[model samples]
Target: MNYNLKYYKFGLAIMAVILTFLSCKDKVKNKVSNEEAAISTFTNPLKVEFGDPFVLDNGDGTFYMYGTGQVENGFATYSSNDLVNWKFEGRIYEGNIEASWTQKNFWAPEVYKFGAKYFLFFSADDKDNPNDELENFKIGVAVSDSPKGPFKDLTDQPLFDPGYPIIDANVFKDDDGKFYLYYSRVCYKHPVESEISQWAKEEGLYDEIEESWVYGVELAADFKSVIGEPQLLLRPPLEMNDRNAEWESRSVTSGEVNRRWTEGSFTFKHNGTYYMMYSANHYAGPNYAVGYATSNSPLGKYQKADNNPVLQKNIDKGGDVTGTGHNMVLSLNGGKKMYTMYHGRTKAMGENRVVFIDKMNIEEDGTLIVDGPTTESIPKPLEN
Candidate 1:
């Protein structure tokens, strides 16, 4: 073959191969883009009637969710590899355990993995308490070797009772290897005669009603007991200037200003700043919403975020979702992204709460944003 002719043939062949590779790369890129577009959004109410939902990733490629209801005997959990679809894992905690202290009102179960063991922190009625039946709700701890657990009580009795009706316990482990417990202290008979209360009384609602406040305390290393006095982390705002007062005062609409609530505390630390996300107002009420406060310390003198009610009802926008509260945040994609898992009410279902998961973002200024209480579909959590 002539030298020039052979070189020309080689050049032609190389060009053909390069063109083919570019064509294939374009096809693959289009396929990925289309797949992402198709998954742009997921509908709200991820599951029917899963209230006070808490999601835990056990590093086993499965996310376990525990919440209120579905088991008369104890608490039930659901599992998902992806945030959208879930599989019922059946009852995790058996209220009928021979030595169980409480047999009823098992609510708001949060699971955490410490070392090789898993801990389930929750609230339930203290059957041994001889006080007014309505004030018997207390916090409890259970343990198991697996994430999907038949968790057994750490003790035969409720965790330390703060001499009040307490519920909605959430535990946080700080960077310093310290553990803290956050819970709601029910205000069954808390009184109010302030300006807000006077306005409520004029509205013809009850002058004195109940409220709930979120409290935090350091935990003993064993995680079975409290290490120090509980610190009042959040309470219903009494004055308008109270950063959270407007959203936290849902009770005032019914003339129960003093009965406002600030509960369901979940804390997350970012960039050395602590953010305590909490729910305010009655869980079943339309005004129930999620808000947060930030501090330099885990056990905080935290201040409410100026843009309060980070997540709440969007009904005014022609959405049917309401009573969105009791949220737990999950870090996904190796902490590249975050999500808020919470419960919301569907218009068709009235006060019955269902679990929903939506994207979350933290601003450069450390402001936490929950991209939800969303009634519209949203993208599922990205996988690793």
Candidate 2:
């Protein structure tokens, strides 16, 4: 053997092995760096997928999320310490049990803490649809001792029915120790004549259009019944010439659907004014968006804000976000700062609705503003 040639070949083999080791080390470093970047920031269309997203700060430094269609025959919840990182807590409420009045199609679950108990208010299909209504959704209450719960139905039947299909239950307690429940009446089979309907017919789009409206009523102290009849608070405008009519009628005007929605109602009292923020347009369509009205009382002759549709799709502005509606407010910093928690869709994200927490503020004049439906890296929600 030529010993000199053999020694040269051995040297080359050693160098090649060293190069491969360095390459792997660099790759590992890059992977760690990317993970760190993701952990350090938050973004819109948050990782949690659910429609009608609601976030509740449980007073223990943890936030809980509940929404529609997250689980079968019930609602699923996600918990987060910083609102950016989330852990699935599984289905917290299950319906359609033995002798349970709820059968299926559960949607829009809202939880509240009263005294020592946590109450979950949600909508589901009731068993007593004598005529077989297409969406016989009714609001029901479930209770548990803990926020992360095995919540059980408070009654065999729903809390109460207003003789129609309803969904999206929201309960609010005023400072004076009185409680209120707000919900949306389903638009199924309830067509109302409007200028938009006339326009639709005049344009030969559809013969009629259906619309959902928001209603609010006082809740009994025991959380078992309503103190009075629900009063209509908001709905789609009647006149096509109305300023809000254009944006609110996008679902019909765009010819994507023949329905108008004023559902997903969230209300809060600020500086003596009752502000009701609601979603308009079909929930499943890209035209879905948010708007608000102001009234002196929880149940109101509310006036639609001039600057309505405060948060909506940004596709026209070169962003991929759409279907931005069904919002609930998360109050922090002793109610001085508010975050609007809602859901949206993106071109890249496809049809799945994802949670979005965006900074919202009430201007000095009480104009409500929601800062997003953003896809870019944003400051984490916990950050001041």
Candidate 3:
């Protein structure tokens, strides 16, 4: 079974509400207190089979979301006024072939708004190059007038593809407006060691295993080209040292995931620290889960979260809720509350990763607490 992240292209802030309700001055109100309301009104919101879920606040009341799609066309977008409900928009753009090495398989399309125009960054492969391995993996740019877009390919050729099998391209801009792209890929194009080849021959070994280290390159002032060499940012110590012995020789390949470490990187700032969540274990098994790391700067040495995995299958139910990672955290209504949006698999749904939203709470120490896919519902809070 082949493990891959499908490409959906182009993908929140909080608000404060002062809600008023009509009442008779003499009547007693059976109002739930804020803490009581929070405990009583929680409901599971998002549901869909997509990865790299990106939520973009349109600056209006509505939010737009985009993720990996089913076709060669770029990513698809969805919109909703309330965080819980969504409406499907269509594919905004498709990759325009610019080089011989780029082919189909668009993965992880991320969109950023720069001034008056919107920019989409996506990964694709070249089908034409036979000898140039560098032409095989690439990232390209597309432009659009709006977030819900009819995005047009901006370059006549791929903006840049290092000629490797690159997947999961994510675009990030610093507070100063510096732009960077992060992704995961194999360590080497060709293997020289017999052990490495034998490992590849294993029933569920990786052709190219994903790692944790992130790479970064400067974006041109126009956001069109890479200004310099891609710099290495992070790599998993477990894989780098070949000490993944605890996980090695496990024969639990029921679905499609092979080997794993680092894939699908997302960044968010919380209480002054930058947090990144990465997936661990094979996506096909119950071991598949999310692990986290944190740093003060976007590019740097990241400290891993506490030993426990952040999200995982309901180990109580034996692969019932497996494959629950590749997620993003969103703030609702100007920091009133926090929510985590991610994907999960259920026995009822078979082997597909569908989106899920759960309200997130912070510990006194400021760490993010993301529990599992819960079905318990609560009453809606009456805002003040």
Compared with the true structure, all predictions reach lDDT values of 0.83, 0.89, 0.62
Q: Write the per-residue lDDT of candidate 2 for residues 1-384, one digit (tens) a residue.
A: 699999999999999999999999999999999887777777777888899888878888998888987689988889998987889999888888886789999898998888789999999999888998778999999999988888998878888889889999999899899999999998898899998999999998988999998999999887788988999889899998898999999999889888999999999999999999999998898899999999988788899999988999999999999999999998888987889999999887799998898999999998998888878887777776
lDDT for model 1 comes to: 0.83
As a TM-score, model 1 comes out at: 0.87
lDDT for model 2 comes to 0.89
TM-score of each: 0.87, 0.90, 0.73
Question: What stretches of model 2 exceed 4 Å from their correct place?
Answer: 1-40
Most TM-score-accurate candidate? 2
TM-score, predicted candidate 2 vs. hidden true structure: 0.90
Worst 10 residues of 1 by lDDT: 250-259
Instruction: List the candidate 1 regions with Cα displacement exceeding 4 Å.
Output: 1-41, 96-98, 254-258
- Enumerate residue pairs that collide in model 2: none
* Candidates 1 and 3, the one with greater TM-score: 1
Summing lDDT over every window of 10 consecutive residues in candidate 3, give the lowest-scoring window. Answer: 9-18
Candidate 3 residue-wise lDDT, 94-181, digit = tens:
5534422335667667777777888877777655566856526567777899987887777656677654556666766777777766
Predicted structure with the largest lDDT when compared to the true one: 2
